[model samples]
Target: MPETVGDYLLQRLRDWGVEEVFSYPGDGINGILAAFEKAGNEPRFVQSRHEEMSAFQAVGFAKFTGRVGVCMATSGPGAVHLLNGLYDAKLDHVPVVAIVGQTARSAMGGHYQQEIDLQPLFKDVASEYLVEVNVAEQLPNALDRAFRTAEARRSPTAVIIPADLQEEEYTPPQHAFKHVPSSPPSVARSVVVPPDDEVGRAAEVLNSGEKVAVLVGQGARNAADEVRQLADITGAGVAKALLGKDVLPDDLPYVTGSIGLLGTRPSYELMRDCDTLLIVGSNFPYTQFMPEFGQARAVQIDIDGSLIGMRYPTEVNLVGEAKGTLRALLPLLQRKQDRSWRETIEKNVSDWWDTMEQQAMLEAKPVNPMRVVHELSPRIPEDAIVTADSGSSTNWYARNLRMRGRMRGSLSGTLATMGPAVPYAIGAKFAHPDRPVIALVGDGAMQMNGLAELITIARYRKLWSDPRLVVCVFHNNDLNQVTWELRAMGGSPKFEESQSIPDISYADIARSLGLEAIAVDTPDALGDAWDRVLAADRPAVLDVRCDPEVPPIPPHATFEQMKSTAESVLKGDPNAWHLMLQGAKTKVQEFIPNRR
Candidate 1:
């Protein structure tokens, strides 16, 4: 008999090879938290201020390590907050498991504090959901199901455990059985190829084009050789999405850059210049820039047939892995001999790349944080992990951070969420101390989740903390600049432009907590400050001011979107969704008041 559900979960986690899980103590999950503490710090439980922060920190862990980042939260709203970060993981194809505490099993049907319909809430966001009510019978099976599904699909999986059942006395099963691969081979599966003419026609589009390009995505993982073949065959350039970052190295010659708002000019402009696009395994959300006859003429190859033409139109949406598809289509492509078009596109690429270099070296103001990002990239230890928040900071790095040789970074992709980098840095440092951690957070993002809990870790670490956790902040005002852009739809933002906001002084906050703190207002000051901070043997924060008005991927004011805005303009009220976006529960009832 299992005495405590926490004990059962602990044993299960041990069996599944879970090394660490981030969490925050809450009323409903205290018993499980206690049980985890008894692990004698062998598998440490990292703590954060909010459940959302915990989940985001875990997201960072999964991104860098390629393991299932685990997080635990209390029942009700606590469990609900985990959904946002879980959505981030699921969409990014990152493996993660969120074990949320529920109310007492005995009080299952009755009303309970901090209770909500979490099962339904999590179902949509999570890849798989397993609920354990009868701990003795279901806990083992549920744990197995949750972990196996998460790894097989590389998405988020969840388990719900009632708080009371966690404390009930019962012994969980042993961890003696050998762990086998979750996915079993399917003999019923058979591979097929496109019709001969279909392949020939698709190849003809590439062969006939004066300027051809390969737009690779996640589908290019196993098809790297195929993509290389096409690029070599036609002298075509390649570009990748953020999720497809690993598909092509930034320094690769044929690789132009990423497309979209964060996309560099080289990729965006180069792709536009090409008459033909071979989209492989990318449902890139922004299709305005993509040649949309949509993807119809643009030959798209993907294993998942349903993803074809999902976001954009696909002219030749071939349903097969990119490697096999290209192999089948290879016999049809005549050895391309047109060197003039390829040479012209190459010149365009070189020009675009030169412009990007110029932008990197462009003169910046005293508070320009781009200078800091550029300088920091070179100074950080090799194999450094950078985690950045949403807001304007996302734009700063999107434009500046160069990742060719020395440094490496991982961000919360898919469901872009803020308030992640700080806690994420913590978890990242704990998980991999050899690789130094650098977290860039916006002022608004920090204010959302960067309070006492952050300092508490610093308090413990100041004396004995890992020397590699380095935190940098863009102390531009406590402002969500994206909101300002959204508000610009109807009214000119002149009044808000001159709105004076005092610098929040996060450095003072960190210093008060007994960690290294430096405020950098000018690039010169940042130079001196960074030198000292980088040399520190403990956690540190360089709170620097930055331009607040930058956001990557500027919004498109479509005629339809503008027409939608006219209703508000006609009504004389601007949208104030920033309050909700910032997760201000107190203002939820006030921001969008419902009239009786």
Candidate 2:
């Protein structure tokens, strides 16, 4: 039997060392489905309920493993469904290769069923690389370039294969005019180090400042040790961009927690007071949360030269890998003689954690959302991989959850999309089958798609060495984040019609899918619930009823924000009294001294 393009595609993916392809079956790619059976699923086809989930799982896998994630879908709607997740990958700077099916060539221009002009559709998302394979000869080069470009640019790339062409006999490109042949599959490695002159200038700026501050982003993951050394020499307080939350552990005395709207007081203070700033591997966009322009002399280190000085007005821009550039800079830096700045940062960090505890323990209608994460912080396994969905619950995950040991975590950092937490955990499981994965999701996100992905977790649990995948849902029965945004940002009362969501028992739903389940409505039960869920033999869901009125107040709330919230209350917000009371109780903790 002649090898079909579908068969060749799978063979090439295997040659590139792809272990799995997250996808769903569709007739547009009937050739690939047949090839999967003929090839004995060499590169496993891990199916998801939706193509979006498959793309998200690939993103999760890529993010955790530092490899290119691949996801496939059939033509039209199936291809359309992959956009959200692929956009998530693009925005967050993840490497992903999407193999999507297109309608048969003969039927493409006739207004055929499921025929949409795919080139324009994917032009933006896969802007790094997008090619349609018209002949078998184009398959290898097109696919290989997609992988190479995705890795080189750290962005999403795509290869479209027409349904009929996939079934045609495969043939290698001829050694003739107009033919392009690709080399064997392997990622080329290169080390980028900024010039010695640039590194020296950055060091000079660092040495001249009285209070130095370091901001680490996800790009700084590889340079954790270097970042620590830099911080130690300069006596700088390190603050993490949310995506870089795990870059440096919260346990570090000089490490302030997450920075931005969902940030901590210590992190806000670190930016506000520092005179010299060093940013590594993070392109955190919220410049307002950073040190005021011109107040601090800044230096940025990033592999991408384009993003180097875009965020802040940096005096020195180092275009190199964070680890290598920081390594060069460290040799030229002199240890700070003053210990006072270091002491102040440590004190601030300590007080912030105490305040987090106090706020987490405060009384609420049922469970304090902050306490849900606070309880899990100490109890979480040192090696656990945690994922959080976007919503009000993200505040707790960002501020309360402390990173320690070999733990890793992420969300849709740049996209800020919902429903990635559960799928991301699923991806994390595949990336490291031995590690336990936990997802902190809000009710709205769970309803959006996290609930459906539970079945995906249950199906794949046995494949993992450790079967403890816990989906902890904050069941507040509200679109809490947007509701608060309405009041805080828009000066408008929460319209119950838009803000309220269905109150469903997520635990019951999880049990129906043959997974362990637990429900906790009281603060006293949160710790025990987390313990049982973490210790479960299989995937589990912890559905805790959280307080909807608990405001995710910014660490540095401005007067305008306060005035807007007051206007919302006066305009008849449904939970005005509870919202104000909870806001007051939570904020008061920041000022209270920890007696313990």
Candidate 3:
């Protein structure tokens, strides 16, 4: 029996080592679905309730595994649904391959049912590579190329297969088209080292200045030890971009946490006072968080030359992989003997941790969310993978979680989308079955894409490799971040009911899905709930009713923010006092000197 076009595509995906392919079924994709079933689940097809959820899972998989994530969708609306999540992949620089089903080739441009022009639809997001497999014989090669391009560019790629052609028998291309048969091209996996002159120039800029600072991003993830070596040699205080939070151990003496509004006081202070800044593989966008132009001599290193000076003004630019470039530059860097600047920053870091501990332990009626993160931080296994949703919960996560040992993390990051946390944990769990996975999400974000994913977890649950995914949902029943943002931005905090959501019992929903779950309303109950969830040896959800009054504090506040707070308080905002107290608590120590 001859192979069908759909079978060939499935076989190629399996050959490419795709363990699971997320999809939402529709008529246009029936051919591929049939082929998937016929293939005996070699690349298991994981069904999602929505096409968007499928795409989100793909993005999460790519983020956690550092490999190409594959997602499939039906024609028209189903294919259209993937754009939002695919954009997450594009913006975050994760590799993803979207297999979209199209109407029959003959029906295209005729406005038939479920027919839409997919090439133009995906043009912007899948700009790296987007093509239709109009020719049945070219699919094997085109599918291969899509995966290769996605991996090489670390961007999303799309390949549309028309329904009519998908079931057609596979045929070899004619001699005219197949003049040569060659091996599939390999994606380059080696690191590129910068030229000696480039490294020397970067070293010269660093060696000439005192009070050096280093900012790292996801691109520097694998170069943590090298970054530490660079920091040690130059007496630099290291700050991380949020996406690069795990690039260095958070407890390192000279390591300041994140670098922007979601960052730390020590990091902000380091950015303010440094005479020289060394940026590694990060395009941290907040210029306000960096020194003014020419305030510090800046040196940037990245594998992509185009991104070298894109974020900050540069005195020297070295184009190479972070680890390789740092390795080459280490030998050339002049060691700074002065320990005063580094020691000062380290002291501030210590003081900042003390302040954080104080904030985490602050008692609140309905459990302070910070307390949950702080408690979970020490209790989770060192090798666990944690995912956080975008909201006020991210504030607690950014400020609290310690990325030590082999612990890993992922989030919506650049896209900063809500509802990726649960799907991200699902993807991460599938990728590393042996590692424990946890997701931190707020009530709003969880209600968006959370419940449907529990069904997914139950469907795929296994005895030995269950992943034991735990979802910690902060059930605050409000869009707390936006409410605080209104006050912080000087907008009137009136009509806040529009920003609020009805209190929903997410634990009940999780339990209905046949997963172990509990709802905890107090801080003391949260610890025991987590212990039960962790020990249950199955996927679980802990719906924590957190204090809605607590504010997500920034490392520093501007005069405008102060004015806004005063205005909101005067306007009779109910949580105004709580916000004020939390904001002051977060920053008060900055004004006091540490006796130790």
Candidate 4:
């Protein structure tokens, strides 16, 4: 029997274990859509209001289930709408398959109403693209490759089936391959321990150095205990990168804080001044803080061999599992009480932590973003998923949030985009209804993509009893913190910096959709607000009107774009000057009484 390309596409999808697909119908995709609907309908299709929403929903599904999220859209504009979600999936390493239907093959380059080159547009975001010309002849190969690429790399891939091709029936050949993919390979790399002398040399340098710090990143997730063990053996303190938040519990005594601009002072200063720094599974970027070649001799331990010397000058590069490396170096490490160095750094780490809490988390009048995140973090179920949008909100949340080892995060690198967390929260909730999902987002970012889905999830999930619940903290501050950072790059100051403005009332927007909503302004109201939302057992939003002047991202926000911020600050404030003084104080205090 022969099958149309559209029909064959659906049959292959069923064989690939796709039980459901979230999508928006289009002219380019009608053939496949109908085929998917008719081929015994093993994988049900849920309709969406918009193509972008379909992509977002697909990403959510993938993030939630650790399976590939699939979506279908028509060519040109419809395919264009998917860029945002596609970028989200790519940046966050969420596996999704965007099956976009393009114009008929004959008019591909004749500028049809909806014809555009998708491969070029998708190359950066998708791991691989299957812009199939012949589904009956090419689908088996395309399907296998698309799914494999998406899963193995934890990235999205696309399969564009033209409208004309979808309607043509051809004798589909038997697929030579039947092996379903299992999972992506762990980034962990195995390496044999070094010779005894190398360990002895590393131990000698580590012990002899008066000041030392252990930096942990997501790389340390698998070797938390070993990292702590090494830290204890050397009497060294520990700090984590934002992604490494839970590598060590918040309660550990030797734990100072994370190191970065969106980080604490004590840990940052101690890290900069330490005589011997040990990087256990941390390929932390921002080498600016990690001074040039010999500021503090650094021992690099990571799963990737190439990453060892790639960032900064490494004194010793140990290529192996962090745990394995530490175990090998354990016997060779020299135990000593370098009281002077440890004390100097400890006082600095301690005082900095206190001051940060005061200035940021425990402020009196206006609410602090940190406190909101801190109060919320402990309250959410320990195992529930956490997704963060990139901005002041994430800096605040990442600095204070901790989800013990084994906790899942929908975080990507600095290519932080908004609207992702909201949809990601949706997908994660769908993925693990057994656990709660918390989405930390700033209004500027969240509004860019999330609100439209308010009505869609309810419509889609009613048939299958939706399990995912989201507590969205929508910070309503219309300010981009990156403007001041622009001034720091040797550019003349704009008298009216544009970082202090407030726009968007997300609470009102959310309430219209029949969901619980809370608006809070003061710090005291935060704890109760979060609690109320969590107890609702349904979709909820905590719209917080925060002080727009909050100083959050710089390393994360280096692009100095400002107009409103300058206007807001010049009219009665000198935030650039004020922040300069505050940042100066934060830096100087590091050398105070216990300043390492």
The candidate that achieves the highest TM-score relative to the unseen native structure: 2
How many collisions per candidate? 16, 0, 0, 9
Candidates in order have lDDT scores of: 0.67, 0.94, 0.86, 0.67
- Quote model 1's TM-score: 0.79
lDDT of 1 by residue, 1-596 (tens): 33476876786687666777788788788778878767664356777777887787787787777667899899988888787878888777777889888888777778867877677888777846556555555577677777767766668888887888778776444554632222221112345566677777788788877677777776566677778778878777787776565565555566766667666656766666677778887767887766545333568777766578686655676877677788998767766776775676565556554443333343343365556776775566656677777766775565455555435465666677767778777767766766667888887777777655466457446333447566788876636455444444544332345433456788888888777888887766766787888788777888887644322323222465435433433443323342223223211322232222
- Give the per-residue lDDT of model 3 (tens digit) for 1-596: 67888888887787788889988899898888889888897688888888888998998888888999999999999999999999999998899999999998888788799888888999999999998988776786778778888998889999999998888998755567553232454566888988898789888999998999999999999899899999999999999988888788786899899889888889999999999999998988999999888899999988878767988889888888898889999998888998899999998899888777777777775788888988887788888888999999999888888788888887888989988998888788778888888999998988888888889888877823744799999888888888888777965663467778888888898889888899998788877887888877778999998887676778877889778866877888877677577666655645656545
For 1-596, candidate 2 gives per-residue lDDT tens digits of 99999999999999999988999999888899899999999898999999999999999999999999999999999999999999999999999999999999999899999998999999999999999999999898999999999999999999999999999999999898988999999999787999999899998999999999999999999999999999999999999999999998888999998999999999999999999999999999999989999999999999999888999999999999988898898989999999899999999999888888989999999989999999999999999999999999999999999999999999999999989999999999999999999999999999999988988888888899999999999999999999989999889999999989988899999999999999999899998898899899999999999999998999899999989998999999997898899999988888898768
Candidates 1 and 4 compared: the better one by TM-score is 1
Residue 577 displacement in candidate 1 (angstroms) = 28
Worst lDDT 10-window in candidate 4: 180-189
Writing each residue's lDDT as its tens digit, candidate 4 over 1-596 gives: 46777776777777778877777777888888778767866687766667776777788788656678888788888899988878877765667888888888888788778788988877778745555555456666667777877876668898877888888895444545842232222222235565667677777778777677788876676677777777776778888777677677765657776677777666766666677888877767788666456778777777657568677777778776667778888777766565666566666656655544554553422565667876776677667677777666777766666556356665544456555666666666556656666778777666666667666655544442434455465464543445445444434343444544346667777778767778888888888988888777467778776654455533222334234334444454455555444444433433445322
- What TM-score quantifies how close candidate 4 is to the native fold? 0.79
List the candidate 4 regions with Cα displacement exceeding 4 Å.
Answer: 1-4, 7-22, 39-72, 88-96, 127-135, 167-212, 280-283, 299-308, 315-353, 360-366, 405-407, 460-468, 474-476, 483-504, 553-596
For the record, the alpha-carbon RMSD of candidate 1 to the native fold, in angstroms, is: 9.2
Candidate 2 runs further than 4 Å off: none
Q: Candidates 1 and 3: which is better by lDDT?
A: 3
Q: After superposition, how far is residue 16 of candidate 3 from its true place, in Å?
A: 1.1
TM-scores vs. true structure, each candidate = 0.79, 0.99, 0.97, 0.79
